[model samples]
Target: MSSSAFRTVPASADVVIVGGGVMGVSTAFHLAEAGVRNIVVVERGELGCGSSGKPIGGVRAQFSDPLNIELGNRSLRAYRDFPHRPGADIRLDTVGYLFLLDSDRQVSDFAAGVELQNGLGVPSRVISPDEAGRLCPYVSTDGLVAAVYSPADGHARPGLVVQGYARAAAHAGVTIATHTAVCGIDTAGDRITGVHTDQGRIACSTVICAAGAWSARIGDMVGVDLPVRPVRRQLAFTAPLTPPAPRIPFTIDFSSTAYFHNSDDGLLFGLADPDQEEGFDTTWTPHWLELFRTAARHRAPALADMRTVGGWAGLYEVTPDHNALIGRSAELPGFLYATGFSGHGFLQAPAVGEVMRDLYLEREPFTDISPLGADRFRHGAEIRPEAHVV
Candidate 1:
């Protein structure tokens, strides 16, 4: 589809998806492929301007939870063939993911995680500290008891992935309305009848909440209190060195919650601060610069001399269990959730799109996603949070 294809929004659509991030666009793409072409995606900003734009694009099936592993595996398959399927090059370099462990407990825990992953058809393994060093030589191995390595886990270009989905969705007859804010969900009784947006009311029965950090507010428009909060995360890009950093897998120092990897021009790194407050705040904290430096020096001392060229802060749509809440909302009929992916939404977008498509069409999903339902929390079901989140 050409750029002029999105000149206007239709008065009615078969499906009205709120949010134009990767999740929303992916949902539209899969739905269109399912023969549900009368789909309209509404985004308050440009496509992928939300958390999807700032993602590090880590794709992996090394999760401890079975549902996460399944989602990752399905997404990994899609991403592997994305260049052909979506016709957009995401620069998917499968350099692998290396998680450095510094304690015996972590080693034992990850060993079990690897076993579980392997059982689920993921070839993740726990490796020795020496092997970890061999895999990512620049990262410090001091005090490291062991490591978990997933050769199939890797990174991709986030912007390209989002664009790929958006373009494919548009080509498949999905209408995308940018700068369109959904002010409210027009519902009759317990069923969604349409969505009232800044532009106008779009009459549609099915409403998908894929608004990332702003998902809770979207749910509120439908009288549903979604248990999703946004937390600020900062990532920095270093100046391109003469030889650049050695091409290494996305490596994480587990104990310190620090991670770094080689990009096309330089090194990209981030650290999780325990002091981070929950909200929609994306302001960069001055004190975090020192923390990041300390983490880099401790984990990858080779990055010590590299000057930070640029950095940006983004939001993580966090849930109580640090996992995503997918599936239909019981209270609000015809309302579906494709939000609260914590920090793993980019990698899990493909699988989520397929699953949401199946559910919206009232067909049995390819994989059972009942475990990711919001009802789990409502019914006091124990939420099994994914252990592998960076």
Candidate 2:
């Protein structure tokens, strides 16, 4: 498919997908592979311009809950096979994931999480701090009590993954309309009638909101409450090391929400700011590096003084419970959503695409996602809080 194909929005489509990040393109690929035709993906900007464009894409199945573990596990397999199936080299590095724990409570919680993950076919295990240091030399065993390591989990290139899925989907005849902002969604009673974009009106029978940080507005267009809020997460890349950094696991100091991993000849440092306010702003604040440096000073002292060349900031489509929303709208059956993934959207995109495809076809998905429905919030229900978030 030529670049011009992605520029032209058609008059109508059988299904209209909002957002062209990893989720949207993945969904389009799955649906197209399943023989669904006349599909159109509408992106406000170029593909992967949203959260999906972030560097340091970590793929892991080390979660406290089974749902997240399953999603991550399934997606790991897909990412591992991406080069063969979707036919793209996403620079997948299976250096593994190491979560550093400080408190006894963190140890116990992670132990339980490891048990659950193991039951679900993930080879995650709790190890001593000494073992953690062996896996990643930079990790200090000072205050660390225990750590969790999963060899199957790692990181990949999000942009390449997006392009891979997008190209495959477009080649299968799915229309990908970039630079097309969705002005509004047209609905009649309990069904999606069409999607109105700045380019034109696309008469679609179904509308899928994979809009990530902007999903709440997309839900409002159809009278559905997605309850998604955007929070800025930032990370910095260190200058190229003189001797090149050692390949290490995607390591995280779980207690402080600070993390670091290998990136090219340097390293990437990130920390979730506890005081960060909710917004769509993605301006990379270099001062935020102080938070990670502070944590690293205590956890991994060597990383605190690393020279940072530049950084990237992106939004995490956060939900109250910090889990993903994946299901069809009860009120508007024609409307489906796969958003509010917090920071795990890129890692879980592949499985989510398959889930959304099965959902649209009214077929049973590989795993039951009933618990992830948007209606959970309306009914005063929330899934268990997922630990191991970085």
Best by TM-score: 2
Model 2, 222-252: lDDT tens digits are: 8899999999999999999988888899998
Q: Model 2 off-target regions past 4 Å?
A: 3-8
Q: How well does each candidate superpose onto the true structure, as a TM-score? A: 0.96, 0.98
Runs in model 1 deviating more than 4 A are 1-8
**Candidate 1 lDDT, tens digit per residue, 48-116?**
889998746789887877888899999999999998987888989898899999888988888888888
Against the true structure, what is every candidate's RMSD?
Answer: 1.6, 1.2
Q: Model 1 TM-score?
A: 0.96
Give, for candidate 2, the lowest lDDT window spanning 10 residues: 1-10
Pairs in steric clash, model 2: none
* Local distance difference test, each candidate: 0.85, 0.91
